[model samples]
Target: MPTHFIKLKPSAVDEYKAIHAAVWPGVLAALERAHIVDYSINHYPPLQLLIATMKYVGDDYDADMKKVAEDPETQKWWAATDGMQESFATGATGSGKDIPWWTEVEEVFRFEGTS
Candidate 1:
């Protein structure tokens, strides 16, 4: 399971929210096909930040990500969504490359519910 923190431009907040309100079915299917589960996206209005959390059930994160990226529908979705995001600062991600968007944050703490 992994959680990611990302930021959105203030001007694009409304458009981003509106789009996610009715996400395309193919996008959802792509995520599931990538072995991604428990996906959630949250917004902070004041900061215009979006935090995404997901459990990756697959063994290979990179490979699953590549599959997701290669999906035509997913690419179309990103084409519409990418412009609303802000890129991470250089050296902000482990990839050693400037991430096009959504900077990854190191989780500092977590509390699990006792079931």
Candidate 2:
């Protein structure tokens, strides 16, 4: 699982939510095909931050991401979304790679409740 944070433009919050509320079926299928599961996004209106969490059930992360990126529907989704986000403040990942958007946050701790 991974958690990421990105800032939304001050004015794009509502539109962003609206658009995601009914994400295109193709986009959902594309994510599934790329082995992304349990994907979710949340918003903090006060800070205008969008938080996303997802599990990648694949051995090759770069390959899975490349598969998602090359999907036509995902490309269209990005075209619609690329302008709604604030410019990257945290530029690189823990791997020292400069990613385009969404800074990955390190998880310090977690608790899975006993059943």
Candidate 3:
């Protein structure tokens, strides 16, 4: 499971929720095809924060992610949502490149004791 954190523009909270309430069918299908499952996003109104988590089950993580990124519908969806978010990049990613959108959160502990 990978968890990501991003901030939503305060003005975009309601609209963002409304949009996700009925995500485009094509986008959903593309995500499923990419083997991304158990996905969920939560919002914190007080801080305008959006936290998302998903399990990637595919054997090739990069390839599957690239497949998702290449999906036309996903690209369109990003177009609509990009303006509603604020990137959390601090240029500290090990890749030495700033993450354009959500920032991956390192998991220090899990209560279940196992994945």
Candidate 4:
């Protein structure tokens, strides 16, 4: 299992929190089906910067991402929230591009807890 990290800043904390409060069920299920686990998000208060972490068990990162991107429901979900993001990079590349608001980070270490 490998941990993945990403950074981004949503337009507003309240708006971002409200959206995640009720994440689309289909998107959640799709992530699970794609072998993504331990998904978590942390925020820097006032700054509104968000750090997302998830564990990926798949061997091919690009392939797994492609599967998630091809999902119809997920595409529709992105369409709804695309405008609410403040991308770190320029150009209107939409969501989940190599250059987007959320930038991927290399993981160094991780420890699993037993529930």
- CA lDDT, every model vs. true structure: 0.78, 0.80, 0.81, 0.69
lDDT of 3 at 79: 82
Each prediction's TM-score against the native?
0.84, 0.86, 0.86, 0.75
TM-score, cand. 1: 0.84
Model 2: residues with Cα > 4 Å off, grouped in runs: 89-98
lDDT ranking of the models: 3, 2, 1, 4
- What candidate 1 gets wrong by more than 4 Å, as runs, is 91-100
Worst 10 residues of 2 by lDDT: 89-98
lDDT, candidate 1, 14-115, per-residue tens: 899899999999999989999998899998878777888898899998888888878889888888887787655554432212353566678889888898
Candidate 4's C-alpha runs over 4 A off are 1-11, 98-101, 108-115
| Residue-level lDDT for 19 in candidate 2 | 95
**Candidate 1: which pairs clash?**
none
- Name the runs in model 3 displaced over 4 angstroms: 90-98, 113-115
Q: What are the clashing pairs of model 4?
A: none
Candidate 2 clashing pairs?
Answer: none
Model 2 residue 91 CA deviation (Å) reads: 6.9
lDDT agreement of model 2 with the native = 0.80
For model 3, what is the C-alpha lDDT against the true structure? Answer: 0.81
